[model samples]
Target chain A: MTERSGTVVGPRPPTVIVDDLHVVYRVRGAGRTKEVKGGATAALARMISPRRLAGERRVHAVKGVGFVARRGETIGLIGSNGSGKSTLLRAIAGLLPAESGAVYSDGQPALLGVNAALMNDLSGERNVVLGCLAMGLSPREVRERYDEIVEFSGINDKGDFISLPMRAYSSGMAARLRFAIASAVNHDVLMIDEALATGDRAFRKRSEARIRELRAEAGTVFLVSHSLTSIRDTCARTLWLENGELVMDGPTDEVVRAYEDSAGRRSSAP
Target chain B: MSRDVIPRHGALDPEVGAAELAARYGLGVSGARPSPVEYTRRLWGRRHFIAAFARARGDGQYSRAHLGRLWQVMTPLLNAAVYYLIFGLLIGTRDGVPDFIPFLVTGVFVFAFTQSSVLSGVRAVSGNLGLVRALHFPRAVLPVALTLAQLRQMLVSMAVLVVIVLLAGQVPTWSWLLVVPVLLAQSVFNAGLALVAARLGSAVSDLAQLLPFVLRTWMYASGVMYSIGNLTADAPLPVRVLLDLNPAAVYIDLTRFALIDSFTAAQLPPYAWGVAVAWAFVLGVGGFGYFWQAEGRYGRD
Candidate 1:
């Protein structure tokens, strides 16, 4: 685990070096006997009935995706549903392992997605604390920024309800709180997965402003969204993905314009 | 804190891709640092984050039930009472056991910690898959947080057990101080299990579904209610070793030594504490190491 040079070499540089990242899911049947039986039959039947093949069917979510994220510039991953945008994000965040590639992050990268909500059973106020802690803020940091988080969410008027479980809050309210908790802290790199979708207009304005601040503070940000407007507004560059492939990568406006033009042409042609 | 004294290391590096640029500016290894030691040091430096999360999880977990935080005391008390009624009074199984109520109650409380650990911990990672993907902190912290949360509840239950003991005519002895070290040992043991469970739990979520059944079988085997002496000599050697492997047994025997059963020092194996501590360390340090090795991987769907 040490270097031969004896200069205390560190982990390989982490400019998000992802080379040929592949994710495959295998669906298996119950019981060893059944699984074994199914596997043998599936293997034998592959030639005749490839689509209906039973046992150990693999779904490749991401296929041989590679990229490098340097410091400063935001990368927008634009893709259709199931296009491997989220998979690529998760892989880079180290949430998912690269089947054949490597993700060398300089340090831990923060990922933001709607699924990462504070416990719905706890009040928004408590959720703010939980979210902050989950985001790697110290207790002292949380205590100091406690009010700022609440105020940013603009749900202070909700009062004692803030102490109520998140189940009581509306979708917009929860989104705002989630954003407030997440954006309150700056990460070395932050990945946002369509978190901006549920926020109201005012909250979107605030959240966008916060994202700008994060970018200005020398953090690398990855925004994955279907909303071209959001990506165009926030990101300098955009990555377009289709069927688990990086279809395009360039300036946000140029990529978005091309993507829109292509989709419009297809619709009109049909 | 005003404006990040340290230079940036990620894609934000102004002199992009220049190794000397990051090194000269002292940016803390940027993306090229190869030493796992420094990598771990950076991860461990987030200790305060772990504590904050533990508190939030403990408070959030307790706030769910109708009785809210009171269930912390009531849950173990209820388990103890049920076992005391069934094993102590109904079965009349503690014929040779000295302090039946205290003995059974302490065993119930101590074992409850371990039981919840394996049971709740089996899903600790998978259950928080969402958070695992979004946040970047030590994944071991999740399991450790769960252990601490459960410990808070267990401590409340222990307090209630102590009151019940006092009411039942048991007097505190000078040896009560030993309980502190014993409890600490038991906690470390549980934390170790938590670490291993978190990794295993994430790998196979089915372990979570199977935990309750497994814990039930383990409970009877480990002597949660009756004394281990009650098992007949004819019982297989493997069964006896299995009993010995039970950290719960060591905890129960230690608690008994502290509270009631002092005469049979030979019956209480000296190696039990050592085994428990060793297991705790092996599992704790080993589990954390294993978890950290896959630190950036937990977020993968």
Candidate 2:
């Protein structure tokens, strides 16, 4: 992959295509069932009753959502809790199975979530190596970028905590380290799920700059964050999902304004 | 909100197959399961990750222990000691067996190697859901890496076993070199079993709870502490033949025959080397293919 330093402004080829994708989560015992009355009698009743016990609940997390993501585009996914933003991102990254329809990507998408795969029992330095290797970097490349990665994360500046177990690091510190490791490579498609929400202003600034750099390298980025300010500052395009449906996909300012307006109305009315 | 502004020229028609759609749009299907050959190639590319993970796990096995890595060699030795007291001294099961201490130690160490690999394999996928969910690599790496870790542990314990054998007054002969090939065969067999266990354990997590009881029965049947010959000497011909063909017993017997002077060729099963190689080939290749077939389903509900 060629590394482009600054923003390359031009028409870019499409890198990710999601066409009428549907993702449903089958949660066991989530569906309603007839309640039994009292202790032993209820247990006996459940045993003999013709009514089916504890049906599977299908959570339609992503329903027929479709969009095209181009190289050099940084897209923001904004939604309320349980609105399928994370599910959509996961489906795009091919981590979650699509119930129907399809997701097409130009290259393997790298997903960096708050619950990333770093071992908490291992030291930060070890985690850096493991994380890099997990991302398909060779041993030599990991050694080459070891210092640069630690410097980018800035976890060592506070002290020598890089040698300490990751369990000792604060959540912000962990998230920053995860971001640093993930952004070190030039991914074809990069998805960030609320990793930036935990970091402070300076870390957030650095992370945003890194995202821009990844975009400039012709990488498609899908960022899911609850913070609208971050979305407005980082993404030119915003997708608003509500209850697993794509409510809007447009310029950041317009979609964010409309989403906030509706949210405001709903809260005021209630 | 206008769908018209965003071009849907290459959007799926819902009628065409995914491959056709990809061909039309020149897009790669995300989450597509790779062909078997392709999957193997991908796995081969991540060989470094496998080795690194195995080394880290092997080193970290005793990180928190008071005695540290001494325990790796000590745990099996202590087990051997207790077995020697019970089965060898008090029970007098060692009457017929020559150099019973070396015999028992070899059996215990070799059997424990496969036992621990299978046990660790049971949790390989379920325990590493964090890695499986966050990263995009072949799931086979988890089980294979785990087997490698157990193999390293077994190697350390085997080094100690060599010293014990030498102390037992057994001279190193040309046949002793056969121990290398025996271990290589056992590693292949254990890796295959690990793959099978990883798949089953991931599908039904209850397998983890039930595995110990099953393995305990297996350990008893494999004759880890005693010679199966003494128990089966009076049995029917077919029963004796079946016991001889038992894969675990076959491996343990091979190692014993290689390392112990008292273990003779007549005591081993007919065509011992042939049986060992066949078991390794069947289990190693077959188990891997079976596990690979379920590659896409791992870590997903």
TM-scores of all predicted structures: 0.83, 0.90
> For each candidate, C-alpha RMSD in Å?
7.6, 5.9
Residues forming the 10-long window of minimal summed lDDT in candidate 1 chain A: A31-40
Please state the error at residue A163 of candidate 1 in Å.
Answer: 2.0
Candidate with top lDDT is: 2
lDDT of 2 by residue, B1-301 (tens): 2122334333333455444534544678787778889988988888898998888787677877888889888998998998899989999889889999999999889999989999999998988887787778898898889999999999989899999999999999999889898899989989999999999999888999999999989888887778898888899999888888888898999999999988998878788899899999998998789889888788775
Mind giving the per-residue lDDT tens digits that candidate 1 earns over B1-301? 2113223222232234333333433343212323457646755766666666666777777676778777777778788889978888889878887777887888888888898877667777788765665665566777877887788777777778778777777778877677778878778778878877877788776888888888888788777787786664567987777777777788778776776633255656558768767767777677666665655445343
Fnat per predicted structure, each in turn: 0.36, 0.44
Chain B of candidate 1 achieves a TM-score of 0.83
Give the per-residue lDDT digits (tens) of candidate 1, residues A145-202.
9999988888766565677788888877877787788889877788888888888788
Candidate 2 chain B least-lDDT 10 residues: B1-10
Report the lDDT of model 2 for residue B260. Answer: 90
> Which pairs clash inside model 2?
none
For model 2 the local lDDT of residue A71 reads 75
TM-score of 2: 0.90
DockQ values, each candidate: 0.24, 0.34
